[model samples]
Target: MAQTEQRAAPAAPAGHSVTAVAARMRELRASWPPADGVAVFNNVYLTVTEEVGRNIGRRRFPDRRGAATLDAVFAERYLAAVDAVAAGRRPPACWRPLFQYRHHPGVRPLQFALAGINAHIGHDLALAVTDACRLLDCEPAALEGDFHRVGDILERLEERIREELMPGPDLLEIVDPLTHLIGSWSLERAREAAWSAARILWGLRELPGLAEEFRDGMDASAGLVGRYLLTPLR
Candidate 1:
């Protein structure tokens, strides 16, 4: 009799239309419904991560332009979401064309930085898992085995992230082989992760254009998705 192997179930699909998702994000800002903020911020992570898998699903992986567009949307939106988390205010500034999605003020660039960092997290997760799957996809049957190692690596990442430890090299085993990929670290141990996390958020201030773009884009993109989280000042 042959032994069986176990694998991670494919990640779930993104739930909303891109524009609908974007629109709902705006509604979160516009209404300042705390629940909505959490929902959209969660969406930020879900959409970006799944988008990566979906890219693989398409098998054509978007060209640089589409990728950039997606990146811009992610960066812009995540920053707004983070600022809302920080300021104890709602997130705002969403955009589309031919209309102002949101026009709130007082929260700006931090929002954008927040958006970018969050996007980075989501992208990295997708890159890791998708590549992990791709790697499993490539191995010869004899060499092929359980995705348990993959699951273990991912679970370790989640735990270390919770504990704020610099995960050992095992995650590299999972994500490193992808064409071009990188992993994130807590920068400090568990006791320091929360502090480092704040610093990490603060450090984002140093990134080129993060401060300014977040400020400007928060309001500009309001019509986009973030506006839903705040009350639009008329």
Candidate 2:
């Protein structure tokens, strides 16, 4: 079940320099135990962020500033969620499941990565887009292309993660619950949901009450799915 609605906190901090964001991630990585679920997800995210930064530096993204800002803003939300958990506060509904089950012995690394992806993409991405719009003074449509481009990078990374982290073929039998879990999620679907939520949140921006309601609904729904994804399977 989703937790009670959180007081509206600013989704992204103002003028959060990318350098500061990177430093925060590194600090978290260094501080957390490697086996902790949040740390596992953080490691994967840090790699992706590093790659995105390198790509931005190389003029890879057509709208470098937009991509960079979006990435930074998006990352800050995740880090904030991490900090909330570490501080013994309730995080957003979308994140509570992951923290609840982070250290469960039956949950594998792949599950940890995917659960984090689910919570981040399903809940955080939409807010991040809105946060980016506020910072960039642009519409969500303007950021659509950049979003897809980043999604493509994420898809490739997901494939690589599966190849590198999945248990050996011999152990992953058709009867394995892991196989079913893996089959149940799609990066494509998560991206589509994020896009839809972004538009909805943007449309409701003027109606703070309605926007907060919608955001909470999205958060609860994502949390529910995340809980399913994190189901212990040994």
Candidate 3:
């Protein structure tokens, strides 16, 4: 289910709201020289590549768009922390923690949750890359996907979430997400699966536990071919 709406509280002390920050990115995008764009692209490629490698071929990347969203969310327009400080408001984005316990002053639990969802958007891109790498044993590098597959993957996860029947290693002997897929994902297919997982997590199902088991199993099975079809890309 989506989040409930929030009441208008005392105007937030300062830098706040994903909306506020998104505004700034627009401004930057407007002025950035054409040539400079390559830098942004390169940075994304480098980071994504590194993360993919670090995860040992696993598909846990923040989507390129999601990463950009983070940049936007914290931009001066949205939550411009520095400007807010100068203007006697507050500050903008930082790498505190993905999850927080408070919703007062600025960071609303709802907003935080929203950010979490948004953050996972990037996972799709990474997911795609990971999938390709796993199957091909090399980067898909430039493959993309169509929407129907993405939609289907999400639909299944949704069914699992709504029914609260996400399979588990304990009862069904079903695998966790890390090893969930049977083989390397085509970049497109992986992205879809990833996107669905991202959205489903917000529903607060038993995803984390399943994720953990997947994580553990993958961690143990890095770089070795095994019975599991999707062995976390290592």
- Which of the two candidates, 2 or 3, achieves a greater lDDT against the reference? 2
* Root-mean-square deviation of Cα positions for candidate 3 versus the true structure, in angstroms: 20.7
Ranking by TM-score: 2, 1, 3
Between candidates 1 and 2, the lDDT winner = 2
lDDT of 2 by residue, 1-234 (tens): 122122211223467555567778899899889999888888888888877766666667788788888988999899889889778999999999899999999998888889899999999999999999998899999999889988888888988987776878954778888889888999899999999999999999999999999999999998998999899988
Error of 2 at 190 (Å): 0.6
Where does candidate 1 stray beyond 4 Å? 1-36, 62-69, 87-92, 95-234
lDDT of 1: 0.33
**Which runs of model 2 end up more than 4 angstroms from their true locations?**
1-14
Q: Is candidate 1 or candidate 3 better by lDDT?
A: 1
lDDT agreement with native, every candidate? 0.33, 0.85, 0.31
Error of 3 at 149 (Å): 16
Local error of candidate 2 at 67, Å? Answer: 0.7
Q: What is the C-alpha RMSD of each candidate to the true structure, in Å?
A: 19.4, 8.4, 20.7
Q: Which stretches of candidate 3 lie over 4 Å from their true place?
A: 1-44, 47-67, 71-185, 205-211, 214-234
Using lDDT as the measure, what is the rank order of every candidate, best first? 2, 1, 3
